[model samples]
Target: MINLHGINCPEWVSIGGDQRRFDDSGKPVDPSTADRAERVLATFVRLSSKVSA
Candidate 1:
């Protein structure tokens, strides 16, 4: 499992066939599928901030 909290995943990949989201432990998280894109963008922003710092 990828340590998203540690490395900062920049993409919100589809976990289930219905565009669901899951955490490293295979649990249902982020109930809003529509927010996936924004979530991924947020991660990229955080990663960029860390990289630029």
Candidate 2:
């Protein structure tokens, strides 16, 4: 895991083709796979804020 809860990763990248998403047609959906990146980034920010508070 890349510790997504601790960093903002908005780009979808392939790592040995194991970190990719697939569509209903069994094809890779590269662009849509990073949708959670922003959410993860937001979570990190929230957690950090709590810790700093």
Candidate 3:
């Protein structure tokens, strides 16, 4: 049996800061601005496919 525990964990919706800004060390602070929705939607489609199939 596939364990579906914690499937809807709130951490799944967490978003990081925009990566347009750089930190003092010249590194991207957080690069999650783009593709957040696309990634989540992809995951939903994948999981749903598994369940339906």
Candidate 4:
């Protein structure tokens, strides 16, 4: 996990079909699922920061 501001963002997030994983940098373990993973890690950090603020 990567700590952003005060949130503990997960290093890998399971998303979309088959629950493909995406790293904290938004890189998918399987390149084929890249489109599905998106930048969810960044999104979480952004949203969490807003909530905490």
List model 1 lDDT by residue over 13-36, tens digit each.
Answer: 465675565678865566665466
Worst lDDT run of 10 residues, candidate 2, spans 7-16
Better of 1 and 3 by TM-score: 3
lDDT of 2 by residue, 1-53 (tens): 35754644344334346447567896557654455554556776776787676
Ordered by lDDT, highest first, the candidates read 1, 4, 3, 2
Off by over 4 Å in 1: 1-33
Question: Pick by lDDT: which candidate is best?
Answer: 1
- TM-score of predicted model 3? 0.40
Q: Give the TM-score of candidate 2.
A: 0.41
Cα RMSD (Å) per model?
9.8, 9.2, 8.6, 8.1
| TM-score of each prediction | 0.40, 0.41, 0.40, 0.37
Error of 3 at 3 (Å): 9.4
Provide the clashing-pair count of each candidate structure: 0, 0, 0, 0
Candidate 3 residues lying further than 4 Å off, grouped into runs, are: 1-11, 14-31
Ranking 3 against 4 by TM-score, winner: 3
